[model samples]
Target: MGDILLRVSSSIKTLIPFRSVCKSWYQVLSDPYFTRNLSLLISNDYSGKTYLVQVEKDLISSPTSYSMKDDIDCSSGCPIGSCHGLLCFERNNSETYIVNPVLGSDDDLVIMLPSMNTETEVPSLFPVRIFNLMGFGFCPNTNQYKVVRTIRSTLRVYIYTLGTDDSWREIEDLPTDRFTSCLPGVYLNGALHWLTYPRIESDDRKLEIYCFDVETEKSHQLDLLPQLLQGRNNLDGLKLGVLDNCLALYIKLGGCFSNFDIWVMKDEKCWANIFRISGVAPLSVWNRDRVEPLMLTEDGNSLIAYAEEDDERRLLKHFDVRTGKNITNRTLIEKGTITSGRRYTAHVATLMSPKHIMKRSTCHV
Candidate 1:
């Protein structure tokens, strides 16, 4: 029976009912080893749903959507980060939640994480500077779930370990004015990757891809940041994504930003060029400025990308690597489904319970 559970562990949603049927079954499914394996979800046969978000005009609720499943609305904004099928959301600039949208409306679905920005910190006009540089990831070394929040207003870093730390604890060595984008860092191989803010010292100085190892809690930079080192448009050329569990870069060449080149990191510094898409590579007038590659599909043929339109709207597109034309209905997530500007984290469905992942409870049935 335990062997049967292990065999079906990959489809976590199927195991949820059995965990309640017997004590021994619950023990096996809840084992850290079982849940930890889910963290390595990226695979060649990847069929995980890529959830998008549409933040309501009232700023009240952001409905999480996937091209596959449009009705999966959760509590708050688009994900701050995603790992092992759980998506984290920030609400009202104060409350945060880690939710499994697959378990929609279930009693044990959302985990309300403790707030990091409280009102009592030495009052200044801008008392809340340390918001937005937040991310959620899985640390393989410990088989633990962690959220790393970098204070954008200041140079401090704080980390929260679920099922362990109830509060956000400060960590050292955070980069000042780096980790610029409020969007969650792309998680791959136990680390989060983000393109740093462009350097202004020289025209040749391009943006660097920064990485933070979730296990060690240390930060570093990646090499050959897929762009021409000397062009004025260099810094804006590269965008990040994860393909086959590896970090991938989408480079938009030329001034009009039409020609595209995709590369995936084989190691810390080694990048292997994967594709080059030419002519109308989904860089429409609406989605030119804000576009990102989501991932390489399971078949290893085309790439799926996310783009925000002109007026805080969003779209997801797929382009053939060889042709570079928009294959709107050819891929898994065919349409962008018109969304808000909120960052949409790639989501997969799983039954990782907050009760098992967090030490404390605010996630009630």
Candidate 2:
């Protein structure tokens, strides 16, 4: 019946929840044909009015021409990740919503989490804090969407499993004194890697990289690049990312004029360098705010940074990751003071979409 339905129509195939139909139906849904069709449907549903900004690139940003007149309230927050063209987002108030922008299919899945203060599910009293630094990744092994959130100062690990009806589960506690706010959590090698500030008072300046295995729920201490750790005398200045599939650490050195260095770890060896920004009068002009999300562009060859340029404007800067140079400088959108606090969203695709590939292919034409 599943195969017959799949042969009859793509629309009807999506109506049946493959995971719930049967083992055979699940296998059929995971088939290449079904998945590809699903991706196309998802892509078409999101391409309109929603766009991913290529930060760190030189592209002229257009002014906001269309307004959200209907005002489908997304005040909870904006959607960030899109899988099969379905966007996952949380409102500013932690109300989760999955929307297909093209199809206009917006489903709100609100789940209440335990409050740190009361430790109980209170109605309309305690608000759930949305950890922006938390990593969102889809686990294929478990066929589950896992959201890993680290409590700001305490290193408390909370995993929100989508399959478990978005229930919050408190995992093993890490060693105390782990201070991470807006810290990036890198998912690599089937584990979540984060820079941790160890508990030892004497080695307060020392920064340790810790890895939490998603499969085993175990934590292991990773060796920090000695060159990077040595310079991290102050905890507030270190930045983290993955460069060329390896751990990349950026350290801010304080002086009369500030200096920042980038270190990449490969096969347990660390390569360090100080990046120079061209067209800048003085290198000191590059402040801590200059570094952004460091995202991969639609082309995957370039890295993008989206940040605010002024009170009235936002800037998207693009860079070539291979050469460590700027490619394009584009502003995504600029708005007046009245719309200053409004949020915008971008989707990060794990699997390259054919539509995106074709869209990029047209660039040369």
Candidate 3:
């Protein structure tokens, strides 16, 4: 009975209802060991199939819509990060939230972070500052979900524990003098990874990888493969993402180069060039516009790229990385349609409950 239910709980949709069968079932499902194992199972079972969540006018009603607010200010608000079945959104550089879109409800699980502008007795400049980087990740050691916000102007970083009364706590300043990229951080292996530029300017501005541990709340630099930085003078036209459970770098070449190179960090020290798409398909079809790599298919053979046909239209195209051939392309949205916002990332559904994760907090507010 319990074992059978656990086996079928690979899908979050099924796990949700199974927990409500009775008190005993709920207890069994809520066990930390059970939840951890279930999360791993879910991750393995659904490694492919990334969702392109569009923020539309009627966000609550649209299946593709993930924005919590129907009238959210898209100019100021955007999906900053996703982790452990939760999405973090920031608005006007002050308001932040963590939401589970699959749950389809904002009543209990939705965490509204304290205003980034709130004043304190010793407040110096944060009240007048704006955060440029935000990320969300789960700390497996603490069994907690945390939101990390960085104020690039001041080199200040703050961490907020979800589902707790604890307010935001400022962490140590980033070691690097320069700020992070406009792109969101990639959460993997209990850490949030970002590409950052150095403060001291050079003829050729190089970028470094910075990672923050969710549990330790510490920041460190990650060395890149020498091959990755050989010809690249700057970080422009490069994006960071997770592929096959590892950190991946998508480098888009320019000036007569049509295809982008995909490099995966095999370990902390080694990078492997897993895929390179060259020739006609992408270069000819996409022209010079940027084509963002969303995610690889479950089979790991095909890769999906998002391309903008024009200001009014966008399309998602699949390519066979092995043969550098275009597999298929589909219209992402219609023309002249104003969605609440548009963002894409790799997502993995999990049965880990936020309420349960934050239930045994030992830290004081």
Regions of candidate 1 where Cα sits further than 4 Å from its true position: 1-78, 105-107, 120-132, 198-205, 226-236, 281-292, 305-345, 359-365
State model 1's lDDT: 0.57
Q: What is the lDDT of residue 100 in candidate 3?
A: 56
Error of 3 at 329 (Å): 2.8
How many clashing pairs in candidate 2? Answer: 17
**Candidate 3, pairs of clashing residues:** 55-340, 56-340, 178-199
Superposition error at 186 for model 1 (Å): 1.1
Work out the TM-score per prediction.
0.70, 0.56, 0.72
* Candidate 1 deviation (Cα RMSD): 8.5
In lDDT terms, how accurate is model 3? 0.59
Off by over 4 Å in 3: 1-19, 23-76, 117-131, 151-153, 163-165, 227-233, 279-288, 311-313, 333-341, 351-353, 360-365
List lDDT for all candidates, in order.
Answer: 0.57, 0.44, 0.59
Measured by TM-score, the strongest candidate is 3
* Candidate 3 lDDT for residue 354: 52
Model 3, span 282-319: residue lDDT tens: 22222434466766664667776666556656655677
Summarize candidate 2's per-residue lDDT along 157-210 as a digit string, tens digits: 566655443356777744334444233356654656666664345644566777
Candidates ranked, most accurate by lDDT first = 3, 1, 2
